[model samples]
Target: MQALTSSFVSRSLVPTTPRRHRVRPLSVAPMTVCIDQSRKEKVVVIMGSTGTGKSRLSVDLATRFSAEIINSDKMQFYKGLEITTNQITIPEKCGVPHHLLGELPVDGPELTASEFRSLASGSISDMTSRGKLPIIAGGSNSYIHALLVEHFDPETNPFSKPLIPIELRYDLKYMS
Candidate 1:
């Protein structure tokens, strides 16, 4: 349970499974052509209030878009705080490649915002370069917001538009 999106469906709700050993690399085909670094890659950042199914939506979308999941939950990154953290179980992930989940030890020093930015940005760039969609998700709305939208002024974004209509925001209604 985490941030829930209006479009979230329950069945594909993915959680992580604990791994006793190392995680193997996914069997994905290499890209034959190079992607231009100048172009921004598509990013899916799932954000909402806590216990709203954000993680579930992320896994569902990741599977739908063949995207990789990256954890932005600050608490879930630690090694020994599993119970307190409410991390996704590995089996629940359904074999999708998840990054930065339980990445550090419980006693490890807290990760600074700058450090997280570096790690998340690096992972996104790497994933995009390989032609996979990068899904950034977690219950930490502030952290996720900082990583995705803080640096840019939305008003100045030329491409920013009302992808989701204002009417849809209410009851998520649509016409046939």
Candidate 2:
């Protein structure tokens, strides 16, 4: 019985005959669109450690590229934490559009990576849709990673295997 089973398995693994190959003629022509580099908006994320002039560089680049600035520092999002957070100055913002900066109250509870990711992603999409470059400036490495890196899905918790908070979806929308 064992021998019979082995022989059957071996026979099953082999092809009965030589395989025939067929080549299909290609008919569809490739289409290309000429894009204007100037019109193509890009997202530039400036990230580093504290006091590294991340904001300054972002502002300068935004000014040169006609881009909008999105604040990525976790602390800089709160109002009245300017000095402590080293938030961008009004002069630096310089009439350039800024998003998610000083929007939350300082006393407000800590915002999670999920929350920040959502807000930043939204700002990026809005700016890009309007044909403006999105410049993400901040010193928070984790916040930057949340934006640029692919991590676990926000919807399903790996450990819990349960549905993630609905807010996570809201936050992820901005990520794209």
Candidate 3:
């Protein structure tokens, strides 16, 4: 029995043991990875109070980056109020594509933050998907807040469901 055990141990330590397969080092360079053309664009949200030149700054930045502009201001959505709302000028919007600017009527129904968030998200998605940067420019505090912050706790506030719809609560909306 002792000799049998010794023979088994000797067999386990034999030099003819088969080796496991090893992974070959990757030869491809990291920089060679192709970037998706759809991801070339980004969304830049510019927010400020009235008369803070948000529109102008957005236009300038969009021009420099060859991006499209999306209006986030509530009043700027109405047409025929460009001077009153200080909306983007026609010349400023010439080369760059502008969305949701002067698209609604002055007497049109008021829009909730939830509605704005949906529209904004869709516009941003469309622009970014097409490899174009989407710049959100506006003076509305709530509009900026909705775009930049997350949600309020449902447990903390029982009325949270009614206070603001689920679609309205975004991660960035709670950041600020």
Candidate 4:
């Protein structure tokens, strides 16, 4: 498996420039369109069924892109299901940093959708701040959807907070 993984990854390590795309927002009323092209950071998400090499692919991409991996497997969060969950081995990571892998105790409560989103978002923010690409890999569709699409209401989600826009972060005179 290691040999196969290494061979596949080595073949795909060529660096390439990022691509730009024009995005049009659908609106019912006429309004000025704003496109934020200044943001350069990109996130890679890999999702698939179990035993489909998702973890392997994520590690490979992380190596090629100088990225950190975030585990999104709902079962992989528990501490005692390493074998059962087929968690990625430390050696398999190939020196790439990984987050949220086997973090919670086995007896602890399962991670809620909002909690997963919050934790994953935090990891993404930290990685982006350090100029590292974030690679999210998992088999959990719900967790992925929650992180990417669901808006958190402050009344229900303690982690809900306004995020500083990239433009504003750069524009603030006191930031640097």
Candidate 5:
């Protein structure tokens, strides 16, 4: 039997016009979240386990709402490991801007939840300031929790100390 060559395969399978990947709405009923799109400060976060299509959903939402995507996946922060970490590709973004996705160096130090919160908050504020919606997507629950639950105001708490003797910190393991 004759083996098919690269030329034969390309000729047989490749379409004459390059086809773009189509984004389809999920068949399942949509979950409700309280988001006032009219409010510029409000952000949409897509959280789920790995391989649950958080990136896909974020891309779709970003495109629909003229928003930008901010990746919250810790593993996807560092450069490389695209396939292993399932980092979103440029084509998949469909001209939507993404922040904090594959932006860190491979050898960079490990990011703490606080750091992630800071980065994500900055991205959110920047997008909101410009009247663009901010869509955060990732599987990192701890990071998402930090971004959402923990409110840090330097102006309000100038000393940056706990209000009481007991620290008001997030215990993720206990919560999880």
Candidate 6:
């Protein structure tokens, strides 16, 4: 086997056709691709177990994409427990806007999954309306799951039919 030299590379890349003549390498200028997303809604959700750099990555992405972060960690919902919950500090947030961080009182009861979903969804909607990317740095998998899926019962098999029939009538439509 013979090793390729720069001589071989330059010769191989040269125009081989008789009339084509040798043209120098194409000088491609840096291209800027701008997509018109005014009518589109976008959100980025980052999720992982603890200490996986989700927050850092979210901040970096938010900075680059002109985005804001939404806190999806259940524990981070309550104020005054940032250290305990491993929530990102303001400095760590890197001046990238963050939403739903420590909004609830520490002594207040934990928000139900439905409540979290509502608040997070509203925040994301508001950010998108304002032309900012919504970066969901999800600390709690359950909360992320609840926000994204229509029904996410852990006991339920996602691929299988629900044990409880959907058509079974109940006067519980008001909950919606």
RMSD of each: 11.8, 21.3, 23.5, 12.7, 13.9, 17.5
Q: Which of candidates 3 and 4 reaches a greater TM-score?
A: 4
Predicted structure with the largest lDDT when compared to the true one: 4
Question: Model 2 over residues 1-176: C-alpha lDDT tens digits?
Answer: 34522542344323455557432211111111112334433455555666545565556556656688888788888999988877778987767888989999878798877788778777766776777777777766567555654453446434455544322111221210
Candidate 4: stretches off by over 4 Å? 1-40, 150-176
Per residue, candidate 5 scores C-alpha lDDT tens digits across 86-149 of 7888898899999988888889798877888788777877777788877778877667656755
**What C-alpha lDDT values do all the predictions have?**
0.60, 0.60, 0.59, 0.66, 0.63, 0.62
Q: Could you say which candidate leads in TM-score? A: 4
Consecutive 10-residue window with the lowest summed lDDT within model 3: 25-34
Identify the superior model by lDDT, candidate 4 or candidate 6.
4
- Model 1 lDDT at residue 10: 39
- Which of 3 and 5 is the better model by lDDT? 5
Better of 1 and 5 by lDDT: 5
Worst 10 residues of 2 by lDDT: 25-34
Give lDDT tens digits, candidate 4, residues 125-173: 7888888877778878767656665354324432355554322111111
How close to the true structure is residue 114 of candidate 1, measured as C-alpha lDDT?
56
After TM-score superposition, the amount by which residue 39's alpha carbon in candidate 4 deviates from its true location, in angstroms, is 3.9
lDDT tens digits by residue: candidate 3, 10-115: 4422335455643221111001101243322335566666654566666665666657887888888888998997776788665788988898888889776767
Query: What is the TM-score of each predicted model, taking all chains together?
Result: 0.64, 0.61, 0.61, 0.65, 0.64, 0.64
**Runs in model 2 lying further than 4 Å from the true structure:** 1-41, 151-176
The clash count for each model shown is: 9, 3, 11, 0, 0, 0
For residue 76, give model 3's deviation from the true position in Å. Answer: 0.5
